[model samples]
Target: MAKDDTGRLHVTVKTGGKRKLSSKLWLERQLNDPYVAKAKREGYRSRAAYKLKEMDDKYKLLKPGMAVIDLGAAPGGWSQIAARKVGSAEGKGKVVAIDLLEMPEIPGVAFAQLDFLAEDALHRLREMLGGGADMVMSDMAPNTTGHRTTDQLRILGLVEDAAAFACEVLKPGGSFLAKVFQSGADAALLAQLKRDFTTVRHVKPAASRQDSSERYLLATGFRRASAVL
Candidate 1:
């Protein structure tokens, strides 16, 4: 089970299978949740994998031999999808994932359980990549308070950091994908991305719950900024 933005444990099961009201409700939802059934049939860790897949499909960002970095990657859901799409390490694709929480090892992918906010974390990620990355993905969300503004700011900080790091390390044609709450990313952030990328858009996949404020920022075509020596 995973916690939602409000620290509520979310479980996927057939709500119609039990007599209790809550159980029946939950089970019915699970039974009807296309993503849940798809995940189970496809052997994925969580239904969230489909979100990335949908995004990538629309943007055509993932490929068979690209280097990728996954921030806040846990339970290996997105990592698994990345690994499969990027091909094996020997074949030119590699994925390096990091989070403050420990995650089980996934074959053909590398992981580091460390806080991204910690000192030298970005440097460590660069070292892991060995070279620049073709894609940087983040599903990071800060610990939420009951206050909406507070939560939005915290999450915005994460996306800002991710975007900065990506600009520093992404290749000229690379892409960045990040999760953000709807209406959370400010104009400043969008302007910054527009300066560095050829294309920038916000996307909300159908798999995401309609009631949730979550959305994603999809940026493509990294532009090499001129440097002064």
Candidate 2:
């Protein structure tokens, strides 16, 4: 590790033997990323915690006593922030998270290891929350095949499914946030969100890597399910 002219610590990963160039680059990036360091220092599960924290700071999405649902919540970074902001740790709110991968326990989060797209997933999440949630958020991304169009389509599909579940599980005036790629393929999803929500906008928090194509669709003030139906 050495300091760059900007005084930022830089980590160099020697490339050789079993380490592929891509793997070496990824490791070097992780080692030098300030947010990764900060996350470790702050006891957050991942650097992604800063993304939610920054978004919530700007939007005031998570509140004390709110019921939150975190979809694709593996690694439990976003769940951790939600649990703290919603006072779940103090028994003042509720947080339920679902992912296909197993995550270690977070103090205030109820974790379910199941695919969010499964037929029974929504039912199971509803059972866990015992009622509608004040907010539904998803940072889920599909596995990339290095094909941009294919990856974008997969991401959009995930976002659509997450939006559909959010509509069913969110209370009136609730909020939804999901990750999306930079492609303009989300017109249909945005149209549906605009119809179901009072406000819909794109958010790219500073914590999101500047080079990443990832952006968030933030929808708030949900219409009641009855009204939508």
Candidate 3:
């Protein structure tokens, strides 16, 4: 291991018998990432936890007693943070999460192993919450196919679906946050969010890698009465 400019030991991985170049590089990056180590130390599920933490700290997206929904939540990083922020453990808040994969139980989070894009998803979430949500968040991304345009479209599609769900599930004056990439949200999506929300913007938190194109689309102050489909 050699120290980088920040004096942090950089762990390097050598190409081995079965490991592909991409896998090797990914392992090396994970080993050397400070956020990964910090996540381990702090008992968080994943490094992506910091992304939501940083954004919520700055934007005040979460509040105690709020009802929140997490789309595509797995391994439960963001749900963990939201549960804490909303005091879900104390029964003062509620957090409902849905993902295609199974997730271990979290103290204050209700999880469903269901696909968010499924037709029954919105109904399931509403049943779980028993009411409208104060906030909806999604950190979902489609598997990349090495085609930039295709990847961008996939990312935007997921965000758009999440946004639509948010619009239907959130209470008046609620908020929505979802992951977007490349140049952030598409113009049409942004315009629609602006019509439904009081403010719409994109934020790239420090926890997101410098070279990464990931950005979070945040829309706050839902106006239920004037919202259009």
Candidate achieving the largest TM-score: 2
CA displacement after TM-score superposition, residue 173 of candidate 1 (Å): 1.4
Per-residue CA lDDT of model 2 for 80-197, tens digit only, reads 9999999999999999998989999999999999987789887888889887889999999999999999999999999999998899888889999999999989999999999999
Candidate 2 — which residues are off by over 4 angstroms? Answer: 227-229
Error of 2 at 102 (Å): 0.5
RMSD of every prediction: 6.6, 1.5, 1.8
Worst 10 residues of 2 by lDDT: 220-229
Candidate 3 or 2, higher lDDT: 2
- By descending lDDT, how would the candidates be arranged? 2, 3, 1
lDDT tens digits, residues 21-71, model 3?
999999999998889999999989999999999999999989999999999
Question: By lDDT, who's the top model here?
Answer: 2
TM-score, predicted candidate 3 vs. hidden true structure = 0.96
Clashes of each: 6, 0, 0
Clashing pairs in 1: 14-27, 15-24, 15-26, 15-27, 15-28, 16-28
* Model 3 regions lying over 4 Å from their true place: 226-229
TM-scores, all models, native as reference: 0.82, 0.97, 0.96
